[model samples]
Target: MDPAVLREDMVDGLESDAKGVLHDETVAVAMRDVPRHEFLEDDRTAYADRELEVLGTRVLAPSTVARLLQPLDLEDGHDVLLVGAGVGYTAAVVAEIVGETNVHAVDISRPLVIEARQNLARAGYGGVLVDCRDGANGFPEYAPFDRILLEAAAVDPPRALLEQLTDSGRIVFPCGTQRQRLEAVSADSEREAFAAVSFDPLLVEGEQSGAVERNRMTREDREHATRRAESRRGWEQEWIEWEESVGPQ
Candidate 1:
């Protein structure tokens, strides 16, 4: 019952003809090398091809990880950004493929971000940077990433994330609401849709888990929205007179 052997069997299951979720041997090898147990609370179930909940976030199933990563077609030394770091398992797997120093991750939940950072460090991917930020804004400091992976679902790719990609960079995420499909888009706006999948919607500052309140009418939420609105231009801006609309109502 060695963890390494469990990893091998996990990869084998993913690669089997019946599943065929994984095709890239490079990615497969990386999955084998990453110790998934370090990121989850239950070490016994870490290698299982099932999702586990941690810190109110569902750690993506192994097949889902493979499905998301295979389309990225990652390369070593590539600068990669993961929008929803979750428990940091996906980021660790990505660090394995693209080199630890080249990986960056962001999450809206501060608790999740703290947990992810600790998990990554424990897994020996201490070089991967995990920060607390709204996934919609992305990690702008590390702009022009070679690839971006969004673990949350959105009606469309976040404009900020798309803008942060390198000229040839590609982003993969689940697109839609009630129904969703895994899709990837390149810098040029060309898109490809893959399997149907469900993911939690991307969250903003006030909507994150353990926030003071879910209502966006709070002072903090309004101020955050106002700041974001002020920075937006043209059709991108939602026509809301913040003070008049949400104040004392």
Candidate 2:
């Protein structure tokens, strides 16, 4: 099948299976125009509305991407900051909605950042900036973005990202560890839960590096470590206190 046909089919699926996740025409058009196959290593299942693991990170499903972006209210010429730009598929979609020149994406994994850059460039979106850095610390050089989308799950919206938004800017991210809720946060620090989603936690400084080290461990040991890491709780209260104390100024 032609890639265009596959893309349209994917869009059709998104519209039907989206469950109100894709209400904006701009977002729909962007999703249709951006070639998801380019960002993915495998083009055969590119349109399958399922998450595919790439570059040691999972690229979110199209439905999940729509859920994360629908609330941001993106517009042409809007500046967007995309956190956790795994392979740049979401960023490419955003670049199509907002101009490529106006979109900046960051990832904690340097290799992923490089791959994302190559993928975006190959897909004719070289203008979209892909940076290798800790996503928790928002890209300050381009402070004050109109929309910020965090593709990874976090306990709460990053304090730095909130501060980097324009007064009316909005951010969407998944909150919680085991039971995650997709949340949209306003510049004023108010948050609203929209949908439930399962996403990997945002990698912090040194976590990505640590993941590289864990490759040497046995499979069973790695599985055991992962379970232990996921079982820890109480991030919600900690996030609330942190928000109250340092709130968005």
Give per-residue CA lDDT, model 1, range 77-150, as digits (tens).
99999998889999999999889999999988899999999999999999999988788898889888999999
Residue range 12-69, candidate 2, lDDT tens digits: 8778755556777888999999988998766758888888887678878888888888
Worst 10 residues of 2 by lDDT: 209-218
The alpha-carbon lDDT assigned to residue 79 of candidate 2 equals 95
What local distance difference test score does each model get?
Answer: 0.90, 0.85
**Whole-model lDDT, candidate 1?**
0.90
Q: Pick the candidate with the highest lDDT.
A: 1
Cα distance off (Å), candidate 2, residue 69:
1.0
Q: How far does residue 29 in candidate 1 sit from its true spot (Å)?
A: 0.9
Q: Residue 36 in model 2: shift from native, Å?
A: 1.2
- The list of candidate 2 runs beyond 4 A from truth reads 17-20, 209-249
Candidate 1: stretches off by over 4 Å: 215-249
- Each model's backbone clash number: 0, 0
